[model samples]
Target chain A: MATQDKSSIFADIDEGEVDQEDENVDRWRRNLRLWRETLAKQWRMLTDDLMVRLAMITIAFFMIVAVFAPFIAPRGPLTRQYEGDAGIIIADWVEPSFLSSESEYLLGTTAEGFDIFSQLVYGSRAALLVGLVAAVFTAGIGTLVGLTAGYYGGKIDDTLMRIVDFLYGMPLLPTVIILVALMGPSLWNILFAIIVLQWRSTARVIRSQALSLRERPFVKAAQVAGASDWHIISRHLAPNVLPLSFLYGAFAIAWAILAEAGVSFIGLGDPNTVSWGTMLQSSRAYSALDFGAWWWFIPPGICIGLVVISGFLIGRGYEEITNPELR
Target chain B: MSDTGAPDVSDENPLLRVEGLQKHFQINEGLISSLLRATMGKEADYVHAVDGVSFELERGETLGLAGESGCGKTTTGMSLVKLHEPTDGRIEFRGMDLTESDDEELDEFRQNAQMIFQDPFESLNPRMTVYDTLAEPLRIHDIENETARIRRALEFAELQPPDHYFDQYPHELSGGQRQRVAIARALVLDPDFIVADEPVSMLDVSLRAGVLSLMERMTEEFNLSVVYISHDLSLLRHMCDRLAIMYMGEIVEKGATEDIIENPQHPYTRSLINAVPVPDPDVGRERVELAGEVGDAIDVPSGCRFHGRCSEYIGDICETDSPSLEQKAEFDDDREVSCHLYDSCGKQS
Candidate 1:
C-alpha cells in the first residue's frame, strides 16, 4: 500500500510538471493560441449574428477610409482645380458628371472648389475620434459614480443621484451648444461637452444594475470575510457591471457623434478641422438643391446615417450577449 | 446596564455568551404612512425577529438551534456573528463585549467568526473559480501560503485532487461540489467558530449525511465551535451536543440533546418533536398538531406566545403573563424549560 501511494504521488507530480510546461511553452505560440481561440469564439458568436456583422462591416469600412484618406480621395480637400468649360474657367460649385473626361471628380466639387469626396473621406476621422473618446470618458466617470453610489447607498447615494437628476433635467443640446460656443468650438472642448451631458444616463443605468447586485449573497459573504468596501466594489461588482457598460458605451458613441454633427450644423463646429458635419454645413452655403449639386450633400448624409445605424447594431449585439434572456 | 441579572461571568466563562439578545426590524413606512403617523403622533411598527434570546457555547461545542419556519432560529444564528446587529443585547466572545467593539476589533472578530449560508449556489460568487473562492478568506486575514491553505481546505471538504476543481466555476460544478466549495471557503480561514444556517437543507438527501459527517469531523479536528441552524429536529438530534428549541423569537426549551428528545418539557418543543416523521411503519407514534397560522411578528401575543396553540394550558395566567426559563425536575440531565406547566407561574399555584 505504501509503495502504491508513492507511485501514485510520483505520477501526480509528473502530471503537474507537464501542465507547467504546457503553460510556459514559447510565449509567442501561447499568444497565438490565445488569439486563435478568441477569434474562433468570436466567429462562432457572430454566426447568424446579423447586427454584429453589419456593425463590423460598417465600422471597418469607415476606419479603412479614414486611415487611407489621402490615397483614396481623388484630390485634396483644400486643393483648387480650374477647368474651363468653353473658356469660362468653371472652377467652383462643379456639378456631378460621371461621364466627363476632363477630371476624375466622381462626386463633384464644393462651393470653395474643394473636392467633396476628399472632405467626406477625411471627415470620418474627426467623427470617429469624438464619438469613441467621448463615450469612453463618459462610461469611465459614470461607472465610478454608479459603483460608489450603489455600493454605499445612503447619504452618498442620495447626493450623487440628485446630482445625476439635476444633470438629466438640463436641456442637453442647448447646454452643450452654449458650452461649446463659450469654449471656441475646439475638438477637445466639444468632446468635453458631450461627456458632461452624456454621463448622467450611463450613471443612472449602471446604478440600477449595481443596486440589484449589491444584495446578492456573494457580496454578503465578502462582507463577512472582512473584505474592505473598495475591494468588494472593484473586484466583484465591476466585472459584473462591465458587460452592460459596454452596451451603454456603444449607444453613447452614436449620440455623441450626432451631437457633434448638430453643433457643426449650427455653425459652432471647430473651424480648423474638417468633419462630415462641416461638409454638410458647407453644402448649405451653396444652395445645394438650387445649384443641382446633389453630390455635395448626399455623401456626408449617407455616411452619418450608416455610422449611426452601425452604432445601434453594435449596441444591440452586445446587449444580446450580456443579457441572454433578451436573446 | 452593567448587570441585568444575567448569568455570572467568570474566568471559566464559555467561549461565547449571549445575554438578552434582541433584534427588531422596523417595517419601512411609505411617504403617506409616515405623514399620517406624524399627524397621529404614533410610532412605527417593528418586527421582533429575535426577541430576548440567550445561550452560552463552550469551546469545541456544537449547539443546534431548531425551529419551524419563521421561528427566528436563523435570525439567532445570524445575530451571534453580528450579521444582523442586535437592537438590544450583549454578546461576549472570549470575555470581551463584542457589541461595544470598534471597527478594527470587529474586523478581527470577523476573522475569528465566520458564517455559512443556507443556499450553497447563492452563497458563492458564480463568476469566481473554486480556487479564488477558497483563497479569498485567507487573503482577507493575510494568512501566509495561500496555495497550501486552499489545497488543505479542498482536502478538508473532501474535494480530492484539489487541482481538478481549482479552476472550475460554480456553474460547472454539481450542486454537491458547489456546496463543498462553499464549506471549503469557510474552512480555509481556520476560523474559531462557524454559524452554518441550514447547510445541508439545500443538498440532496443522499449527500446530506456525508456533508454533515464531514462537518462533524472538521469540528472535532479544528476544535471549532459551531451553531447549526435548521428546522429539521432529526438532524439536530444526530449532530448537536445540546439543542435549543425556538418558538416565535424566544427559546422555549434547551438542554442536552438526548434529554430534550427523550423528555420534552415545553408544549412547543413537544409538538416539534412529534412533527418529525418516524421511519418505522409498524411503530405507533403520537402526532401533536397546533391550530392557527403563525401570528404576526409585529403584533406578538401579550402572554405566553405559544398559549394560543399550546396543548397544555393551565389557566388565565398563561394568557396574561409569559413564563421565564427555569430548571425542571423530571429529567436526570440538566434541562431548562419555559412553560407554565413546568413553572410555578400558573393559576393552580
Candidate 2:
C-alpha cells in the first residue's frame, strides 16, 4: 500500500515537468521583482490612480486627433457639398448613421452641408492650441512675478500680492470677453484675454510657497555663502516653485479652454477658425435645434465636455502630487 | 567703553575678535500703537537677543559657548558669522574690519567663516542632493573643477563610497549622516573658521558622540577655528579648548575649559557644572535648583541677569549695579569672571 501511494505521488509530480515549472516560476518572480522596483522608483499618486489614467487616455485621444486633424478628416471643415450641378443641398442636417455608405456621410452633414465628423476633428486642434499656449504664457509670467515678489519680500511682496488680489477680484469671464472684444477676435487676442485672467491664481499659490521656502535654512546657507540674489531666485527658488506651478498649469489649461469656448459661444471667437464653440454657434445660428438635427450641436457639445472634463481630471491627478495631504 | 577686564596675555593677535556684539529684534506694536509711535517718531520696544557679548577666537582653537536655552549663545554665534547681520558690533576677522568692510570684503569674510546649524534635517535642503549641497559653496565662490571637489568633500566627511551619498537627498540620510553632510559642506570651501551652533543638540544621544568625533577629526584635519555652542557642558568640556559661559546675552565667564571645569569662579558657571548629571552611585551631588524660569530677555534685570536665579547672591550692590568681567590673578589661567562677588574683591585689592 505504501509503495502504491509513493508511485501515485511520483506520477502526479512528474520530474521533468517539475523542473520546467520551477524555471518558469523563477522567471515570473524575476519579472515581478523588476516591475516592483520600477514602480517604487517612479510611482506618483496622481499618475498611479485608475481615474487619472483614464483621464490621461482621454486627453491623449484628443491630442492625437488635434495633431492628425488634416490627415484624418475626410473633408475640409469649411467645404460644402451639393446634390447636383445646380448646388442644391441634399444632406442638410442629416442624422448620424453607421449604415450609410461613403457618399451618405458617416456622421451625417451639418446645415451647411459640411461633414460633422470633419468639423469635430478639425475643431480639436483650435481648442487644444489656444488652451496649451495660454497656459504656458500665464505660467511663465506668473512664476517670474511670484518668485521675485516672494524672494525679495517686504515692499515687493506687498505690492505684487496687492496687484494679484486686484486682478483676482475682477470678474474673470466678463473681463476676458471685454478684452477679447477690444483687442479684436484673433487667436492671439483670445489667448491674451485668457492668460491675463488665469495668471492670478498661479502667482498667488507660488508666492505663498516661495515665502515659506525663502525662510528655509538652505536659502539662508546660500545667502551666507554669498550667492547673489539672482542666482538664488533662478536656481534654488525656481526649481522648488516649478512643480507647484506645473500643478496649477494643468488646472489653468482647463480654465483657458473653458474661457475660449465661452467667448466663442458668445460670438467673440475668431470667425476664420473652426472650434467646438464656433461649431455650436453655427448650429444655433442656422436653427439646427429647431430642425431636430441633434448631430449638428450635440457632437460639438459632447466634445467640449469631454475635453474640459479630461483636463480637470489630469489637473486633479497633479493635485494629489502637489498637495500630498489629499492622498 | 567699559573695560572687558581680560588681562592681555598674548601679544599675537587672535584670528577673530568680536567687540560689543548686540542683536536687538523689534517687537511689533499694535496697528494703532504703531501709528501713534510713527507720528511721535519714537522707537519701538526691542528684545535684546544678544546684548553686548564679546569674545575672541584664536586660530585652530575651538571655543564652546555654553549657556541655558534663552542665553543668546546661538545669536552670538550667528551674528559672529554675519548671518543675522549684527545690529551693532565690530567684527574683525584676519585683520579685516567686517563692520566697515565693503560688499566684496564681506563676501571674502563669508567665504573664510562659515556656520553649521543646529538641526541637521533643517540645515540641509530637502530638494538638494548631497553633491549639490556640498558644491554650493564651491560654486558660489566660483571655484573650478566642481566634480573632483565634491567627491573629495564626500570622502572628507567620512561618507565612504562617496558615489552612494552623492545622488541621495537630505531626507534619505539618517540624522548622523545628514549632520556629516553639513560638516562636509562647511569643509568643502576649506574655511579657516566655523560657527557651529548646537550642531549635535538635535541629534540622538547615541549619535552625538560620532558626529562630535567627526567634527573633532575635521578640526584637526582642516585646522578649523570653531565657536561650538551647546547647553551640554560635558560635551563642551570634551570638545572645546576654551569655554565661554553666557547668561542672558552676557558672557559671565571665559577661560580654558579644564581650568573652568576644575575651578568654577562665577556662581552661574558653578551652578552650570553642578547641573550636569553624575553617573556614580557612591558619589553624592548637590543639586542647585535654578530658581524660577529664565526671565524675559526684553525685561532683563537691572544689575545681573543671573541674580534672580543665583545661589550666592551678595548684598545691595548685586541688585543695584551690573558687574563687568574682570581678570582674577588667583586662578592659574587667564580666567575672567563677571560676578559682583569677585569684581568687588578685585576692586578692593
- Clashing pairs for predicted structure model 1, backbone only: none
True contacts kept of each: 0.28, 0.34
lDDT string for model 2 (A110-154, tens) is: 877788899999999988998788778788878988898999887
Model 2 C-alpha lDDT per residue in residues B1-349, reported as the tens digit of each score: 1122212321256879888899998896667999999999987888898988878888789999998998899888878887787889788886567878887767767777888888888888776778778877887887555555566677777899887886687898999999999988887766778989889989999998888888998888667789999999999999999999998888999989999988898988988898888899877767677888877788778887778888899877778888887786565568888887763336311
Q: Top DockQ: which candidate number?
A: 1
Q: Write the per-residue lDDT of candidate 1 for residues A185-271, one digit (tens) a residue.
A: 887888899899889988998898789888887887788888889888986889779877877898988998898988887788887
Q: Model 1 misses residue B333 by how many Å? A: 3.2
> Candidate 1 DockQ score?
0.24
Clashing pairs in 2: none
Off by over 4 Å in 1: A1-50, A67-91, A96-99, A181-184, B1-11, B329-332, B344-349
For B137-255, candidate 1 gives per-residue lDDT tens digits of 77777655566567767987899998788767788888788888888888777676889999999999999989889889878877788999999889989889999999889999999
**Residue A153, candidate 1: alpha-carbon lDDT:** 87
Can you give the lDDT of residue B60 in candidate 2?
84
